[model samples]
Target: MTKHMDLPEIIPIFPLPGALLLPRARLPLHLFEPRYLAMLDDALKTPERLIGMVQPNRMPGRNGGTGLHTIGCVGRVTQFSETEDGRYMITLTGLSRFRVVEEVEGFSPYRRAKVSWTGFERDKGPSETDDGFSRDKFMNLLSRYFTAQELQTDWESLKEADDELLINSLSMLLGFEPEDKQALLEAPSLSTRRETLVTLIEYSMRGGDGEDIMQ
Candidate 1:
C-alpha cells in the first residue's frame, strides 16, 4: 500500500467525462489523442507513474477550454502496451483521491495540477468494508437495473466478489452520468458509496430523468 506522503504534489491531469476510478479499482484506457499520449509518456518516466483522472465540468474554462472538477483520483499505470497504430492501451490502478489546489502553468499539451490529499488519507490504506451492505437487496436492484438497460454480466462472479470490489467495480463500469460517477468517486466511505450507488440506481429505475439527486 502507498503511504499518503509518498504521493506527488503535482500530477498530470486527464480530464475525461464519464470515467470513474475509485481507490483500489482498475481503469483501462485507450490513448489515441496526442496530448494524452504525451501525458502517458511523461508519467511512465516518473517512478510512481501517476496520472490524475478528473472529470470535466460543464462550465467553460479560461480560453474557452474545458473546465475540470476540483476532485479527482490518482492512478498508477500498472499495465501498458503499444498498439501497432502508435496508440497506447494502458490500465491504471487507483491509489488515492485528491482535491485540486491549482493548475500549474506549463507548455505541455495536457493539463497539470497541484493537488491536496487532506481528508482522503484513508484511500492509501487497505480496502474498506460495509457491514450494513444488504447483498440480496442490492443484487435484486442491480438485476432489475441491468435488465432495464439491456446489459449482461456474470452473476456468479459478481456474487463471489468481495464488498469493496463489487461496489467499486460497479461504480466504475455502470453507465451512469458523469456527475453521478463523480458522486461515487467522492463518497466519504465504503458504506456511503454503496448508499449513493443504490440511490442512483433507484433513481434511474424510477424514471427520474437522471437528475443529480445528491444536491
Candidate 2:
C-alpha cells in the first residue's frame, strides 16, 4: 500500500471525459497530447508524482475554458515509461478521492487544484461490505449485456476473480456513459456501486446504447 504520510494539498488535474480512478483501483493512461505530456514531465520532477483524474463537464465557458466535475480521484504514478513514438505510457494507482475546494492559478500548461479530502478519507481504507454480493444475478445481467453488445469475454476467468477486482476492473473497462461512470465513481459505498453497475448493465441490454459507452 502507498504510504500517504503527507498528502499534498495541491495536485495537477487531468480532466478526461469517461475516465475515472477509484481508490485501490489502477488506471493506465496514454499521454500523447502536448499539454498532458507537459503535465507528465512536471509530475516526474515532483516527489509526490500525484495527479487528479477528473471528468470534464459537457459545457465549456465562453472563454473556451472547460468546466470540470467537482469531485475527482487522486492517483499516484506507480509505473511510467516513454515510447519511441514520443508518447508516455503510465499507470496511476488510485490513492484517494478529493473534492475541488478551489482551482489554483498556475504557470504550468495544465490545470491545478487545491483539493480537500474530508468526507472521502474513507477512500484510503478497504471497502466495507456485507459479503452478500449476488454473483449469479450480476453475471447473468453481464452476460445479457455482453451478448447485446456483441462482445466476448472469458467467463471462466471472470468468475474466478474476487468481488473487488471484478467490480473495479469491469467498471473501468466497460463503456458506461460519462454520467453513468461518474455515478459509479461517486457511489457512497461498494454495495451501492455494485447495484448501480448491475442496473447499468440491464439498461444497456435493454437498448440503452452500449456501443457508445467508452472503451
Please report the candidate that would top TM-score against the real structure: 1
Candidate 1: tens digits of C-alpha lDDT, residues 80-107: 9999999999999999999988889989
Worst 10 residues of 2 by lDDT: 206-215
Q: Supply every candidate's count of residue pairs whose N, Cα or C atoms clash at under 3 angstroms.
A: 0, 1
Encode model 2's per-residue lDDT on 1-215: one tens digit a residue: 46454678999999999997998889999999999999988888988888999988776662135487778899989999999999999999998888887788978889998888889877888755527788887787788778888999999989998787788778888999998888888988877888788778877765655453322
Q: After superposition, how far is residue 114 of candidate 2 from its true place, in Å?
A: 0.7
* Top candidate by lDDT: 1
List where candidate 2 sits over 4 angstroms from the true fold: 1-3, 59-66, 127-130, 208-215
Which segments of candidate 1 are over 4 A away from where they belong? 1-5, 60-66, 209-215
Model 1 residue 201 lDDT score: 88
